[model samples]
Target: MTVLALGLNHGSAPLDLRGRFAVPLDALGERVQGLRQHLARAQPEVAILSTCNRTEVYVGLPALGASACPRHAMELAEPAIEWLAAQGGTAPAELRHHSYLRAGADAARHAFRVAAGLDSMVLGEPQILGQMKAAVREADSAGALGTTLHQMFQRSFAVAKEVRSRTEIGSHAVSLAAAAVRLAQQLFDDLPRRRVLFVGAGDMIDLVATHFAAQKPLQMTVANRSTERGRLLAERLGAAQLPLAELGQVLGQFDIVISCTASSLPLIGLGAVERALKARKRHPMLMLDLAVPRDIEPEVARLPDVYLYTVDDLAQQVQANGERRQAAVAHAEAIVSAGVKSFSQWLDQRASVPLILALQRQTETWRQAELAKARRALARGRDVDAVMDTLATALTRKLMHGALSELHGSAGEAHQQWADSLQRLFLRDTA
Candidate 1:
């Protein structure tokens, strides 16, 4: 079957729509298994790559015996899209408007570019590779990874390594954490005097904590859903820790609030921010929500003294300073192009595999038929030497009969077509 990738990402869909499809790390394995079982009979091999920015399903379809060629893969695109929509409980029509359907060589190139961070919101961001690896591992565990998908990801990882090592694509990389720190500087002249509160004990918070901590803010606090998790990160940064329940109680104590939680709803509403702004005597506060669904309400941005930046909002800031990395875009694109060509050649070999097997089987059938005749002749008291000669002659005729029949019995265009095919089949060795 051909390899295909179908999904929506931050570039293809909005943050709200992407969040609806985002699969948590803990839920990825089960979701993969569900899809595997769902398509087990018609399409057995599949893998899923789900992240904060994207959720894509990669599948291998039987392309030899059935309507499963590269073009057939395009037809199967709707089914794959339907499958993803089923998983996320979304309308297929809605997702279709903002999704990518790439098959065969195109799919390989997409995977390589994504793993290399070329397709990320933040160019050359390294987090996507890890997310991809995790998705593949889950698919493998679910017994859904087959030769096609397995090879695609392995080659993708290799391409990513080559791009990262050979080019300076990441030289101007701007992470969300770094972007938040830079933005905070705009509001507060002296970072050392500003108080920063990071809500959530996850990777985003840890990253934000590290960068802001480097500024040695006057006070830094990590409030997480779990106090224990928050305490560990806070200790590393020499900051205080608090439970997530206290986020509102102490909201006024910090000048800058950055949050990224796994919650499905807003953590801080407009009312809470309004109260915090009033407590500080209308003092302006900068808040960044790195979460997908958003850890803070959108209405907070309307407040006079509160600045609310969502993930997409921060992405703009990251891209604004990404011009330095533009010089290496051509170099990286060249590497990706070479990588896609190599992958396409490999896919070509795979496509010819069925024909090679059919030819070998056909030859074996002819050999067996001749050998059986020779054995029967020897059993009937024929001369062994003569029987051997008869066998060899019969074998050669049997092998060439089908080709000769098609070549001679045909006329006009058909005759020339068969002759050309036979010429290649029999004369390639001599040439």
Candidate 2:
């Protein structure tokens, strides 16, 4: 089977389109299993990496033959695309229009780039690496991962570590959390005087809350559906914990709000923000929605007193820093290039495995037949030297029979080709 990467990322699709394809982290294993079932005819081996900026499906499709080229494997991408489109409830044509497909070496290069953070919306961001590792774990647990995919991802991780250690790609990296803090600073005079509310206790929220906490915000609170999870994060930052049910009742107390959660629907609605504005006497608020489907409603952007920004907005804000590190990016790309070359070489070697096994089996059979003849001769009390000579002759003819037959049967150019191939295979000193 040939390895393929099929999906869309922030670079290829808009946020709304990406959000439609986002699979919840908690259900990743189940989704991976579903994909395997969908492509069972191809006996697919699969792994999926879904993040805020991308949702990619990496798979291995059954080959038409041992020599099947990547282009042929690419023709099988329709099934995977159909399965992925089904996930978002979109038509196949629409998903295909926005998605990309990479086969063979190109697919390997893409995997390496993603693991190294070169493909992230936030260049050199470290979060994607962790997320990729999580995807690998989920795929393995779902029984969808196989040798081809496992090798690709394991190599991807090693290459990512090499890129991180050898280059300054991650130096002074501007993460989404940092960008949110920077944007909030532009809106408020002093963070220390602004009340902050974090809507969820997920990893994104924990990171953002830590950044905002470092700014020493006046009062910080974490609102989550799970009291234990929310309280743990709150305690870590020396903040108060509030039940998510009370979020609407106390929304007006915070001047700066940053929210990220797994909710399918908007957590902060227009009416809720309208009430918060009235309660605060129309005090301006800065809200950043880091969630995919969006924790804050789109209508909140229409409110004149609120500054609402989504992941797409943060993507633009982080581009300046990414552009400034072109040198490091170039260095990292070199690492990825070398890694892709090595992985392709490994794949080529693996392709010869079947022929190598067959050759071994044939030679072993001949050896056993000769040994049986030699043993029978010895049992008849024949001379040892004569038996050894006969055994050696039998093995030699058996080994050369195929080549000699080809040399005698072919003519003209075919004869020369067989002679040259045999020389390379059997004549140690042929030049």
Best by lDDT: 2
Top TM-score hit:
2
| Deviation from native of the Cα of residue 124 in model 1, angstroms | 1.0
Can you write out model 1's per-residue Cα lDDT over 1-431, one digit (the tens) per residue? 56778989889999888877877777777887887777766665788887768889888876642124556776767677787887667889988888988877778889999999999888888888988998899888888888878888998999899988988877667788888899999888899998999898887789888999888899998888887888899899999887788788889989999998888788999889988988899988999988876778888989888888888888888887744476677788788888888877776788888899999998998888888999999999999999999998888898889889888889999999998888788898876
Q: Pairing residues by index, what is the TM-score of model 2?
A: 0.94
lDDT, candidate 2, 1-431, per-residue tens:
56889999888888878888888888899999999999888899999988888999999775532234656765788888899999998999999899998888888999999999899888888999999999999999999999888988999999999998999887746789999999998888698999999999999999999999999999999999989999999999999999999999999999988898888788999999999999999999999999887789898999999999998899799886544488888999999999998888777677778889999999999999999999999999999999999999999999999899999999999999998998898885856
Candidate 1 residue spans exceeding 4 A from truth: 64-71, 87-89, 410-420
Q: Where does model 2 exceed 4 Å of error?
A: 64-70, 321-323, 407-420
Clashing pairs in 1: 1-61, 1-63
lDDT of 2: 0.89
